[model samples]
Target chain A: MHILVVEDEPKVAQAIKNGLLSEGYRVTTVHTGEEGFFQAASQKVDLILLDLMLPGKSGIEILNALRELGKDTPVLILTAKDTIEDRVLGLDSGADDYLVKPFAFPELLARIRALTRRGRSDQVLKLKLADLELDCITRKVKRNGYDIPLTSKEYELLEYLMRHQGHAVSREMLAHDVWQVKDRATPLDNVIDVHINRLRSKIDTNFDQPLLHTIRGIGFIMKTEDEP
Target chain B: MKLVLSFRTQLMLLNTLLVILIYAVAAFFIYAFMKNRIESVELEKLQEQVSTVSTVVYKSGGDYNDWYHLGDQKPFLIMEDWKVSYQTTAWKDLNFPDKLTPGDFNNKSLKTYSAEQHNYLVKINFVRTGIDTMHNFQVVVAMENTEALESVEKLARSLVLGIPLILILAVAGSFFLSNHAMGPVKLLRIKAQQISAQSLSLRLPVINARDDIGQLTIVFNDLLTRLEYTFEQLKRFTADASHEFRTPLTSIRSTGQVALKNAGNVNDFKDAVASMLEDTDRLANLIHDLLQLTRHDAGRLKIDFSKEDLVSHINSVIEELKILAEEKGITISFLHPDTIRLHINPAYFKQAIRNILHNAIKYTPGSGLIEIQLRQEESGIIRIDIKDNGPGIPPDLREKVFERFFRIDNARSASVGGSGLGLAIAKQGIEINNGNIKFVDSNRGATCRMVFPANSAQDDSSAI
Candidate 1:
């Protein structure tokens, strides 16, 4: 996949380009709105990470110009303006997704995956990692022929963790996705921590090979021993 | 030219005009009355003289000289058979009328006649001679009234002459009175101009508290007091915000520097990076909370209120925080009879309840009890009480705990890990939803009491 990053600040543009490249995607970075508009209009890119604030011509003008020409590339807006009106304007101007600044890298990656994967996601009833097995239809979990009892909250947390098996999921993503909290300032870190601790003890306590592991300062990840 | 008059000048001019109008009408009436009195007195004397002359002429048997010897100084004329039969010597030089009409003699009428540039009072009478009605003659008596008219003119002259003096005095008096009345206003204006934002504590002097100007000054001083209070609050908020923001940044900076300096093993370096990242998360949360508060202060939040079941809302909040409470072995008991509907913004209301519940769980010890009671008061006010078996807040510090960045024990709160804006946000959220929250006295621990009106429309927080 090919991606284009249009950001004015050199350091932020370079950082995004490096991060996208490390994930095995061809990355192109542009520093001005004039050049960004040219590249987006002509270049063959699958997804575009466009910043709203830029020098010379603004990001909105570029987005408008490109959209007026019927370029159907999926545009993800990265902006510092998070007011309701700003979000509506970006979406109304044909932005596929909106992410606020100072965002977590894991959340960004998750959004990227959701956007690029679009209609290709297929439903699977059973998920497994090493001896652990979860049945999506029955809402049941088993490891090495032993059934595990989990609370409703524990079940939901484990399911989300298992869906993003190898990627580390930040607390903000869990708070928003699982708890459905729209306000980012809510102090739900402790609650998430407690639920994760319980889920960990239940799933990995009786087995020699632990599938769920903490990524220290980041968050939780579910993977077998040899994955990383 | 369009003339704009000062208030005091307008008052003076109006007063002076009123005085002049009243004085001119009074002088005109008094002059008319005096002139009339002088003319009436002259006419009465003329009639009496005419009677005396007729008697004299009759007694003397038609001898005009005998009546003339009575020494009447005024002019006289007699007409008989429609001809001037006799005339006084003075009457000839006075240019008296040639004839006295017989019609006027029938009633012995008196009339004013003007001849030779002088006004006269003329009295005509018909008298019988020697008791014979056939021998009757008409007597006409005339008096020169130019001197009397002149005296009245003199009186009018004096009256007219007094006007300018009276007008001068009226204008001066009005100006003096208006200047005296407006003296305090001038002083007030000068004092008010001297006060600025830096001197908001300065008060305008109240000359008389019961008067209009004094009342206005008092109201203005009250406005200044409120402005000063708001200014102080803003200053403190700025200082506290900067301090809160600095602490996390300081930790992040120091941790990053120390990690780079050590250059230790891979795992050790990873631990340092993780510590720094933790501080970064703290900073980010603080910034987000600050933005929310500022947005609320700017009145930018779009709040839509609707009727919802209060019991179910609280149940959901409790359910969300149940795991955290259970992890510490704390038991939460909700005591409510049935569903109670209320008008509120569900999002803000739920956040407030969640914050308060989280606080209870954080403060209570292991195996402690937390009770939430929901009921309607007798006055139709819906009340909710959240009480926990933790250390109770003191009476003096109850209100202070809701202030931003206020923690009972800073060291312990730091260790417990919160941005210190939870309670502040909770209070604001409740207030914006038209409810009141306060820490009431409890025997075992802190009891938070929140009350909402039975029915209220969307309320603006700025009003409170």
Candidate 2:
């Protein structure tokens, strides 16, 4: 999947691009309105991650300009403002979705996947890593075609990690991605960690090779078993 | 002055004192004048008797005239002009301390003569002897005394004694009258006590007569009418607050339920999750804004301000919101003067400025213009103006746009949720700091301007 990120701040733009690149999405970054507009109009992108404030042209003008030219590629607004007025104008001006800045990376990946999954129907219901297969509609998971029981929180956590397979996912990222509430602290009882531990036991304990890898000091990552 | 302990008691005492003063003075003069008149009448009668006897005595020359005491015959002498010249008259028969001598009696201012050993007041006058008025020696006599004089003294004493007794009666009468006069005041006090913030529906009682108390009752009832209106407005505000709070909660819950129901596949689930995330951010913004508005309303807008780099705070906020502006193709540039450090409550001030910027960013079209400038002018005013190229406010509503729950008809929506407390909170925050916020003169789009007292570091003088 291809995505265009237009942000005025270089550091945030770099972070988002780097984050999305490792998630297997082709990310193109720009810092100015002229460049963002050039990229949005000229580049064949699956999604556009745009900012509202830019140099040559404001984000709203670029968005409306793109719509004026009838480009239907999905554009996701990444803003640091969460005002109602901002959201309305963003969506009303032809943005497919609006996402504020400093957002969780996993949420960005999810939005990218959802926005780019236009013609791929069969890819919607199935998820696989190593011999583990999750039948999303049926709410069931199978390892080596054998059923595994998982709690609701454990399953949601597993799905978030698998969706960002082979990449580091932080506990904070998981809380935001799974819970979707900002600054919402799910109590310090090791809730997310406990669920991850349970899922690790289910997906790796009986197998000859463990697929869920714990990245020390970073977070956890899931990969095909036997990679190391 | 004693406190009177009771208002009515004091009034009663004062009224009785006035009445007793008048009664004593009147009784004193009446008794005195009557006693004097009765004594004069007795003297005149004695003088007549003396003249009659002297006429007889003068015809026989050098004869003395005398009379007996009324109802008791006793020796007495009547000399010239009713003057008593007695050896012992019935009036003077009782023990008297002194007596009258016969010669040069006119030289004495008064004489006491013993008549039956009683004291009598006498005066001597010579009658005419054949044309020599001065040499006449014919005598007529009478005793000068009356029970009326003594009785008048007794009567005055008896009436004067009744002064205190009348005063007591007047005091009791005044007490009842004063208590009756104050009856309505006590009633009003009781009524006032009963009517509190909660029971504003209660009213002061009004009596039938159109008197002073009636006028006061009318005034109090008008006051109650105003209080009830205020209470109703308070109730409406509470209801509006609850309704505003419930909306964001509803949005969040519905979003969560929608996402959870459709977690069928990766793409479907991802779309649901994204939508839920959007809803979540909205909910958080609402709660944060609500708390900020409440704090501002409580007069603590400056409670959170701290000394910080004003330029950096503006830059950081702009950088944070950079992506949002990018999406809308809007330009948010900061032109803050160099190292303009200010003592500000970061959270509250940011919230205030953020809300205004949000309005500008939201209403302006993609690629629309927005400019944020913070600089100090010569008069120690730090001005912050946020301007945007959006559909500006209608002229009529520009004044009322800062009212809570108010929405500029062209600028608000339920979709991109707002509690309509953003500008209201901003206005409140600025007002608390003795600063001001206003709509700058503009032909198109909205321009919000804020003026703060310059920080000490930025001001040329030490007055901030």
Where is model 1 more than 4 Å wrong at Cα?
B1-71, B75-93, B96-179, B193-198, B457-464
Over 4 Å off, model 2: A1-228, B1-91, B97-230, B248-285, B295-323, B331-347, B371-384, B451-464
**TM-score of chain B in each prediction:** 0.81, 0.56
Give candidate 1's whole-model lDDT: 0.85
DockQ of each: 0.61, 0.02
The candidate scoring highest on DockQ is 1
Q: Can you write out model 1's per-residue Cα lDDT over A63-119, one digit (the tens) per residue?
A: 999899999788999988888899999999999999888777777777888789888
TM-score of each: 0.86, 0.45
Cand. 1 TM to true fold: 0.86
Model 2: lDDT to the true structure? 0.69
Clashing pairs in 1: none
